[model samples]
Target: MEHPALIIVDVQNDFCPGGALAVPEGDQIIPIVRAWAEDFFRQGYPIVTTQDNHPPHHISFGERGGPWPPHCVQGTLGFALHPALQLPPHAVCLKGEDPDQDAYSGFEGLVEGPEGHREPLASFLHRASVDTVYVAGLATDYCVKATVLDALKAGFRTIVLRDAVRGVDVNAGDSARALEEMAGQGAEIR
Candidate 1:
């Protein structure tokens, strides 16, 4: 039987409030995520998580010629999950490993083509018989948006927990616009 999985995206320390690349009130999602994860587990639905495991000098960081601050360096404390979320020890899928690839979407890595291909998250979700995916975590306008869109494109029913997301909102309009766009793409918001 097909089971719905909770695809919790980047809930790393660096994206939490008070971290290197803090999203406003990012820590606020911890309790909600924990509760949802627990509820899903108790309901017997499998949980799969994605972590932004970037290299120390990853190109997404401003220090590495990107627009954002240096954050989520591979294996660093900042790269670990937010402490309060209490992530299950074994549910994580580490992505963004290649420094040259800037993975805004957990669906696929930044690098593609013959030499540096990474696993397609959509295919994994499909293989797992996932009919619906509940996404929650980190910046709404970037990774979360990308993942939701890709999930839809992959034909999975997608839902975004509005209260559990925090957006970087670099231009002040990102949160609202991202939500509108995702909804326009057929994702249910709850």
Candidate 2:
């Protein structure tokens, strides 16, 4: 049977309030995400969490001339998932670890492996026979937007939990615009 997967994207400390690259009220969604994950877990569905685990000199850091401040550096406290999120050890955690790649979508992340091969998020879902994906997490305008679009591109039925996401909102209305774009591309905005 085809199951629905939960893609919780970038709910790390660095993205939350009082961190390196804090999104306004980013921590507010943790409780909701945790509750949703628990429900999925109870139903025996796959839960995939994405983390922006960049290196100290990652290209996405403004200190390295990127657009944003340094955040989610690997091995740092900021890179860890928020303490309040009680995820099971079996839950898949995909990390974007490339120093030069800006992996906004969880599906686009290049996780380090023994043979240096990258594991795409879609492959995991396909392996588990997942045909639908429910996404929620920090920064709706960026990571959430990218993940939802990629999910649609991968032929999965995608749904974005609007109340369970926050955005960087660099342009004041970026979050709203991103939701519109996602809706336009066949993603349900719940």
Candidate 3:
């Protein structure tokens, strides 16, 4: 596809091993994404890295009656991206910041792109003339899946880098099911 952008979703400390909402082998995708990010950056393609930065009382928190434990909380180390991921200077998107809403898709997040101002991901991507989205990063069943679905709905040619993803699998085989569902919904699983 032409004008492809790389969307790395929620590769944060909290989703890695030993953190609050660890995804199995989640950190394992770091090198894969790092390599891809470097290539995309060198190619002058847009690279968008995402974070799940949430307020302490975010609606998705168990403390607020949601199923998930308070994770990726603002100002906490868990909210930070993993040190080893080494992404280039690219757009940064923040999700789960709204205390009243739980955002899983990067499309729902706001991007702090080269403009140095926040705008919706879809708008930023569109402004960049992005016609395709190549996705990577954590939790295949959750954020990655959600991002892919949204990208397709937004009418972009969406592709998932299967080698660069892992999942929490809150339920057994959820990750596998997510990939199938995404493909079924028009996302190419590469």
Candidate 4:
């Protein structure tokens, strides 16, 4: 039997509606994600949540000439997970805390440690014997898309819960295009 994991990507305050980089109606998906996470927890599957815990001077900030405004800065309220997201006690939180990298994918960033470990999402999933991954959360066009693609590349069966995701949609069709791209890469769009 194939085990599955739920990967909630970047459901931080900064991505919700009214935060710095608010995805329109991004907060709306909280209840849906929370319910799914709760069910997954009850089923004894692993639930992993990723957060954009960048530095104040992170390269992805517009102040540093990057595309986005300062968001999810380390130690800031914007860096915290949304108040409504009900993360389980055992839920693994992966933080993207590099100041120089724009970590759009949960699997692309390094976790802070003495050695600044490079443990990615796949490492956690594999450790839990997870073969299928169901992903949901904020900014469908960026982090969610990147995470899905990486999950597929890492040989997990990837599924995107469309209703549980919102997008920044920097461009008019970026969100739609991102979904298409993920599907093309073998992610099942539910």
Candidate 5:
């Protein structure tokens, strides 16, 4: 069996319904993600959660002149994880906390900081002996896409659970195009 790691990316309140940057029907993925998490937990596979922990004045928010609205602010109710997806001990990986940076990929922060880089994923998977990674979470057009791309670049076999993700479809075909791009990059979308 391929040694697999389940990478849950950015299932935060800010990406769900009634959120600042809410994707259409984003909460729809919660049940699916929860089910997958349960399966991974039962199978004893390694699981890692990626959180978009942005500061209050994050550059990715409109308050900071970003196109998007305020969201995922650090230490706010908007930053909380989805209620349905259970987080076990040590499964969390936080990023995008720097108000100046915007990190979409779980493997690495978007912009570099002076406090030395934080790459918890590469070492975590290597130490856990994970050869393949199953990725699922919100905003397929953004963070989910970045995470899968980085996973492939890291030389890990990658799979994106299509049913367990939602996209920030700004336009009509944004989500579809995003999926196509990811598939073209050798990501198995299921």
Candidate 6:
């Protein structure tokens, strides 16, 4: 039978409050995400996570003329996953490792192999027989939205855990608009 998985996108420290690029109330989702993960874990469903791992001079950095402040740099505390957010054994996909890749979508990220090789998001899910994916994470306007859209494009039934998300809201209503866009693209906000 095809299994369903949970994709926890970009829940690292930097996206939380009191970090270099904190999302407003981003830390609020931890308990909800943890509860969902635990439920999925108990059911033997796979839990996949995404991290924003970038170099100091990543192209998305404002120092490099990109829009946002420096955050989630590789090897920094900001790059660490939120401490309060616990998980069971899960696959981790690291995004933005390459300087040129914005990698907003977890679909654009990769997971490590036994030999230190990397695997793409869709490939891993397909290999694991995952037919549906539920996404919950930071910045509804950006990473979460991108991941959900890509999941749909890759032909996976996608669901967005509405209460388990927060957004940077660079603009006043970007988060609301993003939810609409995701819903418009066939992703259900549950």
Q: Write the per-residue lDDT of candidate 5 for residues 1-190, one digit (tens) a residue.
A: 8999898888888888888788888888888888888888888998888888887778988877887888888888778897766655436678887788788899874322237555567887887899999998878999899999888899999999989888988888887898899889998998
Q: Estimate each model's TM-score.
A: 0.90, 0.92, 0.96, 0.93, 0.91, 0.97
TM-score of 6: 0.97
CA lDDT, candidate 6, residue 98: 93
* Candidates' C-alpha lDDT: 0.82, 0.86, 0.92, 0.85, 0.83, 0.93
lDDT of 4 at 11: 89
Give the local distance difference test score of model 6.
Answer: 0.93
In candidate 6 the C-alpha lDDT for residue 18 amounts to 92
Mark the regions of model 5 whose C-alpha exceeds 4 Å error after superposition. 88-90, 109-119
Candidate scoring better on TM-score of 3 and 5:
3
Candidate 6 Cα deviation (angstroms), residue 143: 0.3
**TM-score of model number 5:** 0.91
Report how far off residue 24 is in candidate 1 (Å): 0.8
Off by over 4 Å in 6: none
Q: Indicate the worst ten consecutive residues by lDDT in candidate 5.
A: 109-118
The residue ranges of model 3 lying beyond 4 angstroms of the native Cα positions read 113-116
When 4 and 6 are scored with lDDT, the better candidate is 6
Clashing pairs in 4: none
Which portions of model 1 miss their true places by more than 4 Å? 109-119
